[model samples]
Target: MPSKSSARHAALTVAVVCSAASTLVLTAPAHADSVRIHDIQGTTRTSPYAGQQVSGVPGIVTGVRTYGSSKGFWFQDPNPDKNPATSEGVFVFTSSAPKVAVGDSVTVTGTVSEYVPGGTSSGNQSVTEITKPTVTTVSTGNEVPAPTVIDSRSVPSRYTPAGDSAANGSVNALTLRPARYALDYYESLEGMNVQVKNVRVTTATDPYAELWATVKPSENRSERGGSLYGSYDSQNTGRIQIQSLGATADFPVANVGDTLSGATTGPLDYNQFGGYTLVASELGTLKSGGLKRETTKKQARDELAVATYNVENLDPSDTTFAAHASAIVNNLRSPDVVSLEEIQDNNGAKDDGTVAADVTVNKLIDAIVAAGGPRYQWRSIDPVNDQDGGEPGGNIRQVFLFNPERVSFTDRAGGDATTAVGVTTVRGKARLTASPGRIDPANAAWANSRKPLAGEFVFHGRTVFVIANHLNSKGGDQGLTAQYQPPTRSSETQRHAQATLVNTFVKSILTAQKNADVIALGDMNDFEFSGTAKVLEDGGALWSAIKSLPKNERYTYDYQGNQQVLDQILISPEIRRDRAFSYDSVHINSEFHDQISDHDPQVLRFRP
Candidate 1:
């Protein structure tokens, strides 16, 4: 992987490549006299010059990356080419930092290679690089090529071309169509200097000093100035990741809706994360949009307020307890019942055998009371150490927080992480055999993931079944900018099975009693329109409450310049039949740079 720095020299240039270290197979070098950078790039995702040797490739050094394991410098040919399908710039991969500086015109002889950023299995497009180069500086202080402007007119409305079926839906062999597809257009400008003026931020700056902005500000934009990923077919092409090539410390901290005023100049590059990224050498001024965090109105006197929030691996070592408590109290308005996900053990990521989270849970409860909120009580089962997949020894799980004044917990005995919970009939009414119990814990579907925790709660003498879940994440899924046209979501298989189990459990409860109130809510880690959600809503077992809001306001997470729905609250017919429920996806964290969590909390209010 590439290294990051906080300072830069007088020559302003951005390193566009975030390449992984790779080995090259040396062979006899061929003498190709008529080859240029564009000829090496060809017009496809893979270069036609791949595996072939070329000599006397001439270009001016535009950027020099002195750090990172894959130390290299990007050079651009100043000569003009009529075809827009081919890029004039390419990176020369040197084992160590190249002695060349920016504006140095040099001739290189090397073998053309395609390096995949995250390995071949990532499905990401390979980067065209000249590996094992012999560089000879012919002149110094030569002018670099002019940067191409990236605006709404340049990027296409279409995302990508249809992949070839013969290659398992891979677009790697497709010819470049710069004016038609967005991915192709970006590919045409790969490793070349580009600029975007007055771009609107779609995703906040993350810990890696990277942010995303949209060239087409009005294309499928949400009301809050963000691009919406409503479905697989609507992949917005205007969004592009922005990372600084100069000083990481000098990168602007931006939030969604903010503007990077003036021209942000950089070279267009492709990486493992976010597909097409602009590594900025010259940054623009940041103008705040004044995007404030949203607060939900207080629930009515007779209404039951239930919320789901992923605390993002909360433990005693975390310092965001006060801010999180304030968000729960003032921003969320203190829901009657709050389902918390990613509640880590007391030691956080320590690999100790301790699985109890009493210290972690108690600290948050105390902070909530200190923030002028209710005296909340939490209930959760400790999992076996190193079994649940998370931050190593974090042992992250779901926990329930209920306000004693507005709700009452019905605790049944013999509930553990390994034991499965089942529904039973008590006096002709549906009830859980073990309250605060795991749902199908031993099932293969939940192998390294958090099992659903079923809890029995009472609101004004009405029984409500709440299942908190933190399903397996979409870790192995291919990205939208992958070499495949429609990226494969390999991680969905486990989520589908997990959802099916939850749906089956809900169906079992409803079968025991016709009008049982059941609410399954948490970080589903899948989109609302995904197949996983379809399986959960199968046989009319439950309906996603997030659909109650407008399509533009349905997202509970912002990722990679797309406002999407990953966390949701699905309710049974007993809760959805009556149109008395009000749902709010409170926008507190996902849109802000200084966030306690990456997911926004969701609240559902209804009268039983």
Candidate 2:
């Protein structure tokens, strides 16, 4: 974990419990005379010697992190205690480059502290550290601690035990049962040198010079060699993050199905991003698994293909326009109507009150034409300046790209960002009052989020309603390694509200005309099994089409090590009752390091 800032350390003058189950223990003496590493790192999440001084702590340096904001050297005690719960290693925070090398026997005297990354507001567990240290090298050329093998046998199949119910579901106070739970097993060896051999890469190498691999290759493994995250209960415990302690340029690039051949030795450190990360002093050799991107079949003559792609805050200045265009044209097989999310304004985050995305959309259309695809016409409403919650001044909103030759846009006038779209009966058919209109944009659910863009289109002379949405993100949700068991997801409130509003709008359309063909699709930003999806599917208004795919193949986004679904396409009963439609989550981007966007695009093909 990163070193606790001076401000945070100063603010934490007294012992502060990291979890509800943690309490300040004054049972130990005021100051430890000769404290071992395991003595300082007790059996719980918080050290018993926290906020107390320890002198002459002896250990051999296992790894030295010379870069980043949190520069420190990890050392492990040569002799371990009888109990397996207490860790025999600890991180000595130096605030800068540490003047230590691996295999150097050193004696450290410092204050034992628990440094919580991302502050206490983030529900992350703290990393035990010794801050403001005075280091003395006792000897040189001493051997480092023998690396512990973290294979399938070491990591338990069970992820975690139930937290103490009285302590707000916090497992901090619970004793570490290393053999029983995977989380406890990792926590027991925190800051200790560990090794993994012949591990399969679960997530591709990211821009941050990091990758994820799993010790247990078969645990919820996807067909494409990724660990699938199907539900909240099944967080794959064998997956772990790996980062190099060397230069970023020296780090090897890898894909999802790649393998880390040979032993990769590292100190297991806890961080804010991925909970337990191995900062590898010795990186494994990257062996390609030959994983290739997938392509979906082109829509047939009678089928109307509708696709959704989140262009990851696309703007005029981005060089990824060509790649994104290729993905839509080649990978997605050129869908008839594509819902594009995160299309930035013309100025592209310049903050000059420019919210129009005509330049952006037209540029993409031109690129699509250049890529030998159909000339797609676009329709979208410019959101209020800085009102939509994305990159500040970017004004990210959803746009529709329709093949004019295959589909005709129903352009009813007078639709703006704040105007609410309603359904009305026109010649015994359901018609949107404003074609390409916002769905309750003024509602509190869309306060700082992208308002759902509802559009009316005529596909092969049949009227179809498509509502494109990019709901509130899961920015503040607690991670799987949070201090509390079943961490809180405060961001779901807004998404649930937004889903309810969209569901009501769909019901209104169906109420106007019973068998109206309606398809609501975009970056839902929630899983298929989430409460938000349930709300959208409530009252039988719509059903998520992605559910048709088998559980292992239902992912559109890859996070850390788990392949999960954050984007969805929901269809009305009239369209889904027959089960004749086809859905494809084209995995062109998420599992590759050369991705233009982080999320893979999804396509739905049906006759409307």
Candidate 3:
């Protein structure tokens, strides 16, 4: 009964949920005449009895969701069937406030539905539901079903089944194998009351009032109390999202490594963000990890600081310029040079073939100066119309903002939007033939993507080569919540190719000058541990500065419940061997809900 907009919004939510799956146990009543919740849920993501009327569906109302488009109450069978594949509980979508109380044993009649919360085009899984119920309160004050305990042993360590060809890889197929796969496990317990004990927070609490946690220790556990979000092959099945069904205020603000001990009891619910979430009515106490917002690093006159930040599609029309500028100046300590990604066209997303970003760059520069930061001189090669893949017509590309007082750009002739930059030996030194030139623009790896912009600058009388990159994103790749366990990371293939191209260029620079100071940094759109990073670091030509930090402090981005590294700075051997480098993943944006960009900028201070 949700309105069109709310249904669309909910559909989007479910679409996000389809990215991953969780584990749970379900039970059915013994009565043959009365339809069980499992019968409606079936084995696939879609319900078997969808669009059909059913009578005498008996359950105890465990929780009620009165807010949002999904205003309904959840009920589950007290006498659960022995089948592990079947879910004992189901959501009764009333479309409005339902006259149901917790602990009330009710026999209801309604139509079964497979509702896609985000709408049809969202590519999300359908949540089986019962709608338009005519309820009969069999009794009040009935005991609720005991919550299922989910831990490392109870939930499957593996994330997904090997094959999803059956039932299109949906939980609705009724082929629940909770012991084998995590998705199957969560699907089996969908809507059932569940409990997670002694879990550590894997993702920080978001404004959406949800947090992801790893139940017990995981195989890819990080030193700082959270599990590493490994490659797509490893789904991190131990992790599950936690949602407070009662009050948003009750949900604790927690960071990665924080602990939620005692009994966090709630009903298993499926939504768009995290596939399976524990909608807990009773949340345990949160043990803080002393994870505080980091302060700006001290900058020295001899140290040349370089930083990479994804502005998240900054345009002239957007109003986040001030916040972003403040972060750059205050949080990043006003780095001498900053490689900025996602600088949109002048008119932003209007897409009217206007590819110039002078207006956008000027606005940001003006803001940075106003925010107690040094005035920056910007350089960029505008993309050929809408060739760059991003917001339609936005023409997002990478740009360099260097403080004129701290560093000077080594501008050479012949650099244009389409021409590829080459490493040339000038006066027996490795230097870019065309400063601020694209790296292999004609290469297939850069097709429809923002090509790397190579700029030469002089810092402390040394020629330093900087490559600003905004590589192909993980757009077509499956989300972690994908129905297919071990979701496909189709985006990595392109990123690997892109990394190879950059590495080749770095090798060319090293060939010209063995001790060339080369720094490649930006949003690579791949994790540090990914094969793409491995390819970039091949032959020791360049090293990811993030890896130099402690294992726990390597992330600059947070997705789902996993603190990850998407933004990075890679330094050449000459710079690395100098051993006079300091790096910090500026924790200004990614962990906070009120963030200016989804990515937290990373800074590297070194004396060349």
Per-candidate TM-scores read 0.95, 0.95, 0.84
As a whole number from 0 to 100, the lDDT of residue 366 in candidate 1 is 98
lDDT of 1 by residue, 528-598 (tens): 89898999999999999999899889898898899999999999998899648999999999999999998
Q: What is the Cα-based lDDT of residue 331 in candidate 3?
A: 84
lDDT of 2 by residue, 1-608 (tens): 01113333533332232332332333453577788999988998888888788999999999998765677899999999999889898999887889999999999998787777666677778888887899999899998899989999889988888888898878888888998989999999999999999999989988778899999999999889999999888789999999997888888799998999999998999887778988898888999999888989999998999999999888889899888888888989899999999999998868899999999999999999999899999899999998988877789999999999999999999799889988899888999999889998999999889999999989889999999999999888888998888788999999999999999999999999999999999999999999999999999999999999988899999998999999999999989986489999999889998888889999999987
Task: Provide the overall lDDT of each model, using Cα atoms, as 2-decimal numbers.
Answer: 0.88, 0.88, 0.81
Which ranges in model 1 have alpha carbons more than 4 Å from their true place? 1-31
Candidate 2 off by > 4 Å: 1-29
lDDT of 3 at 104: 97
Report lDDT (Cα) of residue 213, candidate 2: 94
**lDDT score of residue 479 within candidate 2:** 84
Per-residue lDDT of candidate 3, residues 1-608 (tens digit): 01223444544554433122311112232223478887776665666676677898999998988877678888999888777878899988786788889999998887676665444333445677777788999899988889999998988877766545664544344466788988888888888999999888878787667888888575576655666665656667788999998889878988777889799998898776667889998898999876655656867989999999999888898889999888888888889999999999899778689999999999999999999999999999988997878877888989999999999998888788888888778788987889879888988888788899999999889989999988888765655655544456777888889999999999999999998999999998888888888898999988999998887678888777777889999999999997599899888776654567778899999998
Q: Least lDDT summed over 10 consecutive residues: which range in candidate 2?
A: 1-10
Q: What is the lDDT, from 0 to 100, of the residue 280 in candidate 2?
A: 91
